[model samples]
Target: MSSTLTVTGGAPLKGSVAVRGAKNFVTKAMVASLLGETTSRLRNVPDISDVAVVRGLLELHGVRVSEGAEDGELVLDPADVEVAAVADIDAHAGSSRIPVLFCGPLVHRLGEAFIPDLGGCRIGDRPINYHLDVLRQFGAVVDKRPSGIALSAPRRLRGTRISLPYPSVGTTEQVLLTAVRAEGVTELRNAAVEPEVLDLIAVLQKMGSIISVDTDRVIRIEGVDSLTGYEHRALPDRIEAASWGAAALATGGDVYVEGARQPDMMTFLNTFRKIGGAFDVDDSGIRFMHPGGPLRSIALETDVHPGFMTDWQQPLVVALTQAQGLSILHETVYENRLGFTDALVRMGATIQVYRECLGSTPCRFGAQDFRHSAVVSGPTRLQGADITVPDLRGGFSQLIAALAADGTSRVHGIDLIDRGYEHFAEKLAALGAQAVRDEEPARV
Candidate 1:
């Protein structure tokens, strides 16, 4: 497949696109299947590269992965679980950071695990210290080496109390995956309460794990001796839905996103409406339309759940470029997330990056030197320019900008989008976007 796209702009994107399972949750759920003793069935799986990476890693460790009767269903059986060779595991290094997550499950199943150095999108600092600390607290031995970290359990892991410095979703997932099989009760403070995390908890519960969530950011899990497989359907990708919604707003188009649930998107929906984007919610999905006027500029901040998501900011920033006045965005989740706006500026959007906290409250990055905030002043015409895909969300944002720009744009590294977006080219086609793969003849 081609890694470049030729995009012709000046037209609004219109039509419908379907979103499958969330890349964030489905990949973690696939790892959870490693804990099951029998065959686990997963539905609504998207055909993203991250899922493929996890599947390859799972198969390397002796899990039998197969397709189910229905489309988007996966059958994973861990009956023949075994220790993967260090060299073999090392070969998968840099492909994904998911190997770090395999530590708890692999140790529980095979007594030891070798995880190569991790790699992921370069949005900001994503240290593995929290994951390592969580594993050590559970009585696992961690030996750091040049190639990767090696972990082993001398005896059955015993759960202990843990408190995260922040409500990190990845760290929270590590704790949950490890805690369920530990020997005692586990108490976690400052856990992420995102809907995806809650869904993961539901999946674990179906596997006979005792877990509880308090009103506060607290999670408790009782260790079980054994776990059976589970049948689960993953949740839709709310981030993708919001991205398309932003696309519609940026291009003055109307797009109906199928499979978008309103409950998981209330925060984003509220923000979208405040920006002069109109939406209608139904049982199946939501239809987003630009309400034929100058978009209102508003102050927004990215935070944990119940607040705007950091991932939703980049693409929406593209829409903000079309707003009538100045829009302030404070990114609290990842410090370098605002870096993608440079490309927007190159494409003729008036944007300025800053190092200070521009939001109502201070964040962890406020004490640091990262440029974590942005000011976008707009209603300026966007001109097409050459763009390169940065990270996942930023790359998608660039695509949205290209579609909304005037004239033609040559976008490189489009394959990066395949990491999270499933069948995006087809989705663009259905939405009447004038984009063609660089490998093919350009359409007039």
Candidate 2:
């Protein structure tokens, strides 16, 4: 059995919806609080399940988290940080990869850290090897067990040089969180400069750490002996904002997304414009709408920061289904990202996934047998169908498909959608879509 949403199609989702913190940064910022000797205040936090999950994990480890002076604010105090029971740690962190981030702060504060089995979206192969290897470079010894991995600093962790084979966002985060309080200066090459990472750096700076980022992708962090509290505002979630923008384009709707920063979405905005979508930018937010014309097609490829993000690719594919010609996308970031297109195909979208790279330059997965490229032919009228939600971004793409199709569409497994999107169903209702709830029996 699963929770389902029945959506009536052909209605534009026109209205304003608010977006809070970037989930990528807020969760890590919460983990950074474990390094502080005093209370840390994080504002503009979103009411997402990931935030709640991280808060629970922090509370489990004796970190105190409470509401701040305003709504969407969190006060995290690390005064009582301690090692938690392994079973409780396992239970609290069920399938979340966040526990891996606790290693650096815990090793500095308590000399040891235990990470339960890690989990995240089933997008691709996300291994903790990069994280573990980085920790080892910092003098932490790692021991593997059945339940999880245990890490201990035989001596105080010391800063070391690191060069990543790729600019993986997760590994870069692990390095930044751990390097801040290490014994000496640490240099990281080929680091990720995504906006979320930069915002996390801002949070750490407010907490009394010295870090530098160079245009050549080199980040140097000087370890400080001690740190205090911080009061900082989190960057708004650009992924969520882009998701709604793609939705407006797909349904021919007008959407005003409050708190969406234009600088963070320049790549996506440029691509949106090339596809014939119209947008207006203002100080408060950006508004995306259809200009009542036939949408043009585009050639797009997902890449690292400052390129089209893999997270943005999934939702935007929904809009491509309505374009006038062929839209080709080379998903260079994640090999299995195109898996979600299967559900879109079921919903009457003419999308084909390929193994070889379809762009000018072949990416890492080009030679691999993974389906990493897609060609979508559109101006095709979509119809309603029964679909199952795949992952977080994919789930939203499914929702867009359902909203754009004619007649009623039944979508199952929306609990996956709740992981990142906050009150999405309510937001959809507010946007004038005829979306309603329905319960279903078991699939097997």
Candidate 3:
């Protein structure tokens, strides 16, 4: 059953919050554990639902999984793995995008793999075409079944040259995982260089992968015969950090985002500064706070990497509503990302969705009724209301907006937010935000 969050409004949050290992990278790294013969001891792992989902998939394949007392670490014992439970694999395959990541590793270990359908944030029509196409290029036979993807590598895998139409993060990860264990050299251009992707590469390298990154977004990987287990710490989740930063600015409070890396978050940091959010970064973490006066609004475009991230745009847009000036946001990653913002509009935010493309930026978004662009008129006085969560990141945006609004809010489908966020209820409490779990059903 799903859960709901009841938030009492009007709180000034002040506290130190530690970020978790990235949900994106850690799940892929867990899948990589299947490729190695030794046990994979992953550190700084987050206690998120996605991680639990991946852990279930790994253990279903006969890998022994164990956890520590602290929520920061996990041990994946893939030494006795058996690819026997196709039904369990099929059930979870439809649950997340990370299950599709296991295809390359499973094919390498068991010669054939059946992957269930992938489900993630419904921001756009996220096709697995590039991923399938890249796998096919590596000489794997792929058949799209009703339940999942059936894959077979008849011969030993061989890598080839591949370039993505767009620098998609999932497809890039697919190519990296499939090509690293295949024969010959694989060259990838226009690859995703997100921090998560880089962390995956770091994990692969520790597991005996020979990967080299060059200028102009080029990546070359040499396939090896065998790989051993890897022990490594994951990079801090930038999305979670950005979400809390947005919350701090929106609520006119001070928050220290511990374990957040500054170098990987320069784009977000700069944009938040433009929005009148002041921050200080040391080796440990980042501290975000509001200035004395009204916060400003800045134009934003969500791009692949080195650009503003698509996931960060939703929560940041909520903070923009409290800004004095107008904010223009062009969602370049997903077409339907702005739909969840409509819930904010219902709570007194001045936001309008547009069909036309705002400007010519490097994005797949075109002139259509996709509502890919959002224009928010600021200084909004938001009133709390009952909100339903459509997806993980969108749910957190609603939570932040609700915390910043007046009165109380009942956020339904709160469990969806827990799929990615770690210790959010306790963290909210730590920040002086009053939140309680409602046992009764939430009224839509």
Candidate 4:
């Protein structure tokens, strides 16, 4: 597929598109297969690049990966798990940050593990200090090499108590993947309780790990000596579902997102209603639509689970551009998330970014210099312009903006959307979006 997409806008998108397993949960669950003694089966997996990266990394470590009888099913066998060559692992460097997650599971199967430098979306500060610190607490020796960081377990890894300064999803995943097989019990405070994290805990439980979650942000895991393989179906990608929902609202269309569960999108549903969007939920999926009336502006703040997700804000920002009056979006999760609004501004939306915390509650970024707050003044008519996709979610937001605008737009860097959103271009076509892959080469 070409990297550029030419989109003709100003039409409502109406139809249904199915969403599969979450990119966030599926990748980690694939990594968890390394801890099992037998083959594991995972279902509802999506055809995303991130999953392919993890599968390749797993194969490099000698895990046999194959398809199951059903579509979107993967059978992973780690019976021959071994150390991958440093050079081979180096080839995957900067492709994804998932490689760093291989540290604990690899150190368990092989006495030592080497991980190339990690790379992910250029969102904000995602330091690996928390991951390294938690690993060191589990008795793993960390050696920083030029090519990548090497970790070794001199003795059996022991469980330790940990309290994260914030409820970071990645750090919490690192702790869980490491603590599941460590000796004794591991208690983690201030952990992320996102649906994806809970789903991962469910996967671990199926694999014979004793895990408990409290009402508060506390998790305790009892280590077991051995684990057998598991048969599990991953949760649907709520981010992708919400992105489509936002797209529907932005274009004044109706979209039925199959596999979108109501339980996972309560907060977003409430916000969607507040912004004059309507949804009908059934067992199979949810249908998101813009009510006939004007879109209402809202005050939203991005937070962890049960709060407005940071990932949900970008595409919704496009919807906000057509809403009546002013809308305030204070991004408390990633500092640079609001930077995507600049593209919306270039497309003729009225948006202003600020460093001050615009939400009711002051957040960690309040004192920082990062422009994490955005105030959108809208009911402005959007005109299409040439756009360059930035990151995954941001790229999807730009696509929504282009579809909502008048005239034509040529969107570059569209491949980035494939990293998280599964077959999005095809889905857009299924939804009646007037977009086609550009046959000509993308501009340098």
Off by over 4 Å in 2: 438-444
Stretches > 4 Å off in candidate 3? 68-71, 440-444
The candidate, 3 or 4, that scores higher on lDDT is 4
lDDT of 2 at 27: 94
Candidate 4 per-residue lDDT over residues 1-444, each given as its tens digit: 348889999999999999999999999999999999999999999999899999999999999999999999999999999989999888865668998789989888888888787888888988899999999999999999898799999998999999999999999999999899999999999999999999999999999999999998999999889898999999999999999999999999999999999999999999999999999999999999997889999999999988989999999999999999999989988988877778889889999999998888558898889999989998988999999888999999999999999999999888888899999889999999889885556456
Query: lDDT of candidate 1?
Result: 0.93
Q: Name the lDDT value of residue 367 in candidate 2.
A: 78
The lDDT-based order of candidates, best leading, equals 1, 4, 2, 3
lDDT of 2 at 193: 96
Task: Assess every candidate by TM-score.
Answer: 0.98, 0.98, 0.97, 0.98
Question: Candidate 4: which pairs clash?
Answer: none
Ten consecutive residues with minimal summed lDDT in candidate 3?
359-368
Q: For candidate 1, lDDT tens digit of each residue in 212-258?
A: 99999999999999999999999999999999999999999999999
